[model samples]
Target: MSSLLLRHHRPFLAFWFARVFTASGFQMITVAIGWQMYALTGNVLDLGLVGLIEFMPKILFILITGHVADRFDRRKVAALCQGAQGLIALGLLLGSGAGGISREMIFVIAFLLGTARAFEMPTTQALLPNIVPSNLFPAAVAASASAMQAATIVAPALGGLLYALGTHWVYGPAVVLYSCALSLMLSLPARQLPLKQKVSLESLLAGFRFIRSRPAVFGAISMDMCAVLLSGATALLPVFAKDILLTGPWGLGLLRSAPAVGALLMSLWLTRFPIERRVGPVLFTSVAIFGVATIGFGLSTSLWFSLAALVLLGAADMISMVIRSAFVQLQTPDEMRGRVGAVNGLFIGASNQLGDFRAGVSAAWFGTVPAVMIGGVGALVVTGLWIRLFPELAKRDHMHPQPNPQPPSAAA
Candidate 1:
């Protein structure tokens, strides 16, 4: 709200707060799922399977969802997705309360939840550009990223503590949060997306073509995928908290929240001073720092040390994320926003959820510390390779700020 760009934009405020609540809801749900799954199976690979299962919806629906976002009404799509997720969360609550929830059932719910997200994420991501003027978008991305990080900062740790009261404590709040998020999305006045080109394979793939022509976007997105695809160690947090750090579910939540604490602080700073120059080099450097932090986290024995490492990496990731997202959103026209955002979301999903799967599998195969440390080294390698391959991203200097017609006359 302190950002000049968002201070008076009531529509974006509704959007922003919905983001906060939605993220808070998910943080608790994620903690509950990971901890409960691990507790039930006591197998490290089950943690990875959970991540892999959640990622399936994105793979199955990726092509169609983006096309849907571009062709359909984004707000309704987003609102509907939220409503579906709310039902899923409510189902989780009832099943758990009834003592009928099983590991397989949890995986089924994760897939359903992921399907809703696959549609909602790109639509909401595209929704922002419509609500805000073009020139202010970098700062807007910063402010919004801060909202997500802020939610992460409080929710996971709180979710963890609440888990002590049982998952009903976690799932119940999530259902309410999703309801609020759904209401906010619905409150937006109706508007149609630019009519998409007639449905066809070529039209469906336009986003893919647009990105191919833009080396910087492709590089930025692919580099993020390759780097995080190795270093995403969140799937192993339950393992770290229980066996390695010798702490309970609360400790796992704190560990999960640590990175967001750093990301939230860094994003707030970025909001005040949006990236203005040498963005390419800055992006590369941030990812490099991420690699170092991951290695540090891998080597740590104490809980505090692990938290510090996670925080540092989280901050580094905030820099990389803000740069990549702003660059992609600004580079494309509004007509292409949904398509491009869908592809962008795909890369993000691969990096986080698939990365977790990779981490989980590696942890199962090589043991935790070695798997993590190796992943960190792999990130550094990817960074060096990307700099060599995508000189455009490294040498890029400015975001090419666009003109704003006036303060957006968004729904009041």
Candidate 2:
């Protein structure tokens, strides 16, 4: 299994390590931002705004970023983005050290960081296919997902501990990690595709057109987007940690890490026993399970119970994430990968950041518990609706790219 996953793939391994370091640092920064923002404002809505601030750049420049990723060297783009993120971390560190860091300053830093991410996400995603053999793509995806989950598992706990010391402590190490990721990215073999002769509005929008013409890709991305948008409980974790469960920063770390722990375990399992059939049903079932787990998490006041629910949620989400990633990467043509990835990133950014914003506003309108519970119910409703609306997705039996059963006209 190990050989199948990582044998003779040094560049891929480097990419994986880069992911680990980058993800860990980013996760640490995330924890510090959340805790410090909540500390400063004592407002749950501010926590949600953190995501919103980060998301705005992606909304603004994702298309251009994706086009750049396709037109230039993806590795260099990623390296440049990593360097930008490292600078942002340094900025955060300096601001924290200078004392009296304002909420607005934090928001500004978040926007800059999000800007770096907007470029980094599509470039990094598009680089994956270029790094490894086509036949080993699934294994590579599984391994990459596992590495990310592992980072998520460790980073939050580490960040929480570092945050307990000082917010600057979190930023300082994050700077180092981001620098390391930049170095690794710089070292990767360059694979720049030839640029198109002419740029047009149609070329820029081709990814959208492709997805619209392929129901499976459309269904998968839309389902994950809606489910996650409704069910996401991550943004409200600090509220639960401080007010509901009364766990404190340390407890918040554990709460944040719980889902990743489950995800890591599931990713490891998938690496060993790759899902070969009925992938659509697996995706739907996992999402439904994720919704149920979110409901349980929303209702739980106890730390242990909440952790269990989050773990289940993570496990289920892992399945959907792996399947969806494979679908997007495998199904799309290489020339269009970056643009498609950008669109996918947009969906992800909207779901995660906007979901946090939604949670925050809802928590402000209703109580925290009610907001989370309602979101969970909304996820369940989305799952049912998606299944009914996109029955072909449920019938999708394999992960490998296949001929579309529906004609383009029917898909539209």
Candidate 3:
């Protein structure tokens, strides 16, 4: 059982460590940026606009980036992107230190950083399958994803503390962390997938056509997108941290991390027992739980109660993520993984930034409390509607993916 997780998966372990470090440092950068922006402008709109500018370029370029991933060496691509991001971090450090931390500079840095992520996310995701044999891909993905969620749990609190110390100093440490990630990438064994075709518009469109042809895949991605878009509580977090909950930066960090802590715990447990058998039903149920948790969170006044609600929301989200990731990876051929992963990344961007925009707009109209509550309810409604609309999702089952299954004793 332990072998199912560790000994046989050495390369994946390296990848996991690299990703965790990268993600944690990025989270720290995020807090530092938000804090700095608010300090500089004292405007909620500025905070909201940061997400917008970052997401725009990513959403625009993600599919093309995915095509590049499928057609090239994913690991090398990841390295190049990471290297670019490291340079950006250095640029940020210099600019901030030079006292050039203006709104325009922030937007420029955000856009450039987002462009780096646009390429980075898909290649990193597509690279996972080649690291482990096909049979172990699911386990590897779950474990790696758990590590990512764990970073979420760890980074924000650490980031808030570091940001509180000083934004300039926080970026310096983040630069070190990004450099460490780059070194790890450089050390990785070369992982390249067979190229079916040169990267082109036709190839990219074909990838979308492939997704459109598969009802299960399409349904899963669509459902997740809508659910996340509706229940995006992260957008309103700074508001809660500052105004509503009155907990300030420390409270803000804890609140941001609570869901991820729940997700990390859930993903860790899932590695031991696969959630493959009833993936369709599981996804729906998990999403429903996510909605309920969000609603509860919106209604709660006490800090502890709100934290608990977000934690439950995170655990439920993990359930959907494990199944969806495994399903997408299993079904996609290596030649197309990058494109598919890119599409998945686009939905993620939509869920995160567009969702934040939605939350911000709604809050502007209905007040923060009502906006969150409505979004939670909207998530619940979307889940049910998708289940009804996408019957294929309801019928999904994990068939024997390989010719021979290890008996339960031998199973990961």
TM-score of each: 0.95, 0.95, 0.92
Model 2 ranges with Cα > 4 A deviation: 4-7, 401-412
Superposition error at 164 for model 3 (Å): 1.0
**Tens digit per residue, CA lDDT, model 1, 128-176:** 8877766766567777888899899899999999999888989999999
Tens-digit lDDT track for model 3 on 226-268?
9988888786787877777777777878888999989988988
lDDT score at residue 245, model 1, on the 0-100 scale: 96
lDDT of 3 at 9: 68
Name the runs in model 3 displaced over 4 angstroms: 1-5, 397-412
lDDT for every model? Answer: 0.88, 0.88, 0.80
Mind sharing the TM-score for model 2?
0.95
Error of 2 at 157 (Å): 0.7
Better of 1 and 3 by TM-score: 1
C-alpha-based local distance difference test score of model 3: 0.80
- Using lDDT as the measure, name the better of candidate 1 and candidate 3: 1
lDDT of 1 at 262: 92
